[model samples]
Target: MNQYQRTHETMAAYERLHLAAAEERGGETLAAAWASVVRQWRVVLAAAGVGLVVALVFLAVTPPQYSARALVLIDPKNDFSVRATRAPTDSNTDSANIESQVEILRSDRIVRKVIEAENLVDHPAFRPGVLSQVLSTLKFWDRETPAKTELARMEATTRALQKQVTAKRLGLTYVVELTATMPDPVEAARVVNAYAHAYMDGQLQFREELASRTSKALQERTEELKKQAQNAERAVEELKFSGSLQGENSASARVALKNLESTAQTYRVIHDKFLERYAETLQQQYFTVPDAQIVSAGFPPLNKSYPKTLIVLATALFLSAALGSLLALLLDRRFGGARLKRDHFA
Candidate 1:
């Protein structure tokens, strides 16, 4: 029995005691976790019940909204009766054109037309309440006098209408969807249909105006060319008559006659060209190719578009349960630690 052998025996006994203490503490930890969960069960259920009530109240108070949608198909190739001579660069050009049409659908001019046509100025959705108007006037008093001019009312109505309507281009296609949401299903459908009609009418008017202007220009040029041709023909006839009366077929007279005839021919050729263009422009005026075709007109929706009660209730229930569980665990850690220390002292 040396000093080294005695030290080794002491270390082995200490390791055995430490291992037994760790095993006992692990069992206590599992039991404490189970006790915390059991104590919080009532809190979790109460929180869930409160959440359900709040969701129900919200569903009761909110008004139902109906959505209507109109679909328009844009064919760039057949956009106008007079197609451009230059071809598109690639397929991407078609996408760009479709996007441009989408912007046109959302433009203020088109929306204003729809609003005026539908008489939406007096509609509750398009007109703000008295309180909101007062607030807006107060907020912008320093910018200018708050007089409600026709322009101001129009601007306000346009802004409100813009909020209720939306236009989206279908992905990688020539289709555009114009959607409107309102409290009345009939009004929603009417708004969307108005948008479609207004857009098509605008396109028609634009093309007709363009063709009218072109026709006017061609008509003026044709008149001028006719006069020039008549003058040239008169000059040739006068020269021929003078040569014949003098009985002289001189080289100078022949040259002059040839020059006059050539000028007249040239003028006639130009006049014919102008006449052809004028005729084409007139035909274009009668041409009735639609810029955008209505694939589907808007219809009144059968059901409300918003306030999904079940989804709202389920989300509230899940959030409340998570919050309640977290709070209970925190309280248990705070109080349980204090009790354990007091017991240890005792």
Candidate 2:
């Protein structure tokens, strides 16, 4: 036989061998795949057992967290003071205002007040625990700096408290939800309640400060106007008396008196307006209107919020099964293919 015929025979033999191999493997039947999985059931169970143990260990070690929530209503319409002064023109303005209030609820000023009120600075949740401090000292081989300043410690506590608290606006509504999470349910509730009160107090303080300043300015301006009005009235009287004493009531003298009287009247009008404003500002200084009202107060949670055992175990089981199945299939393909190649070559 020539070289070309020999090459053709070789190609035909390879095709036959491929066909025989496919037939021997039953052309990838479902039964065979299931059998392959069944044969590797031990591997699957072992992986699942390992995953379950790890999950249990995590559940044992991880601390449980509790969440407390406070609801606040930011109703501009209900605020008689603000409504009397200015009304929002559109819904967009109202939405923006609500969002601004949400940010304010999460502000450092509010968070810091919550921390200080709850005395959370020394809390292990917010600061390092005794064990952790000892470990850190050992790791640093006693070369660590003395300690953070009081201001730095307070700032750190504030940041930690801020991380555990969240403020969210409830969908197009005038309500905001303040949430705080902590290991202790009572502490969580206290922190959230403190946040609401702090925000309310802060708003009142801001308004009182503004009103006090305005009252002072108005009082000073009214005094100055009163003096000017008095001076103008005296000038008019002096001019009238001088004209009468001289018996010289001329057109020019009359014009001068009329002008002075008009100036005095203008000052009186201005002084009266300032007095009214001053009274209003004084009232506002004592005003007790709240910018936000607590719709729902936070209470100690009945159940822990973290380390959901069932969910963790379920997720571990699912992932372990998937991983085991993939490994089993890969091993079967590798060893089975190698055996087939050896058989075919022999």
Candidate 3:
């Protein structure tokens, strides 16, 4: 055979051989992918098993939290808010001033008061036994740090408790919800009730403050009016007694007398009217706490709200299995040379 023909035939044979080898490699790649998945099956199972175990342990060790809630109807009549001062309604009720009250309910001042009411700092949950309480009680010993340091520490504990308690607004209604959570059911109930009581007391205090301020302002105004009236009366009397009327022209004298008399009369009328209005305003100033009835009380929760065992365990198991499957697929891909570079030099 000619050299060129032989060379052409050899090239064709090499091309056919290459194609067959490539086909064989592709088949092996698929088999290896399956093998990788099989190899990693044990790992996937182990991960899932470990995840399940951890979830079970968490469920066993963690203690459950108890919750209690109370509902309060905001009184619109008692709610004389600064916003409504420009155009006040005929009657104020609990419902009218709830927005301000809601802010108060969640305030630190209320939280601190509630903590004080329960004496929560000395409780077992806070300090863990009588010894902890005794150390807390030794106030004078820690003179360098200040007694407030201990109080601050106690405050931290109370702050944590406060965070757990919440006051929420009812749906388009004039009701406020006060809720607290504690290990003991009774403590939760007491704390919630105290919050309601404190809110009512605060309302009464607000009214008293308004009344006292208005009274003081009115009294000062009344005194000023009285002084002005006296001055006017003195001027009239002086003009008459001095006999300036006789010395001046007859028409001028008459005019002066009439002017003084008119000035005195105006002042007298103004003083009388102010006195009457001030008296009426004073009579209307009175602060009273509204009677709040509890709509619901918090009770001991029968079940714990945390450490969802079944759900956690199931999630962990699922993720572990999925990871194992992915690892298997990656190994199979590598063996199949899914990523390869052609060699031009060869």
Top lDDT: which candidate number? 1
TM-scores of the candidates are 0.78, 0.79, 0.60
Q: Across residues 1-346, which tens digit of lDDT does each residue of candidate 1 receive?
A: 9999889988888888888888878878767766885787787778788888888888889887889999999987774445533465567887888899899888999989997898877678777879987887787544654564667778888888888889999888889999999989998999999989999998888888988887898899999999999999999899877754354557767877888899999999999988987888889899867668899999999988877777888998998877777766777788888999999999
The CA lDDT of each predicted structure is 0.84, 0.84, 0.69
Residue ranges of candidate 3 with Cα displaced over 4 Å: 1-49, 72-85, 88-101, 126-146, 168-175, 233-286, 289-303, 307-346
**Model 1 — which ten-residue stretch has the worst lDDT?**
79-88
155 in model 3: Cα distance from truth in Å? 2.9
Estimate candidate 2's alpha-carbon lDDT, on a 0 to 1 scale.
0.84
Model 1, runs deviating above 4 Å: 1-38, 84-90, 129-131, 136-147, 235-263
Using TM-score as the measure, the top candidate is: 2
Ranking of all predicted structures according to TM-score, beginning with the best and ending with the worst: 2, 1, 3
Greater TM-score among 1 and 2 belongs to 2
lDDT of 3 by residue, 60-81 (tens): 7776556678888765654332
How many clashes does each candidate structure show, in the order listed? 0, 0, 13
Cα-based lDDT at residue 260, candidate 3: 78
- Write down the lDDT that model 3 would get: 0.69
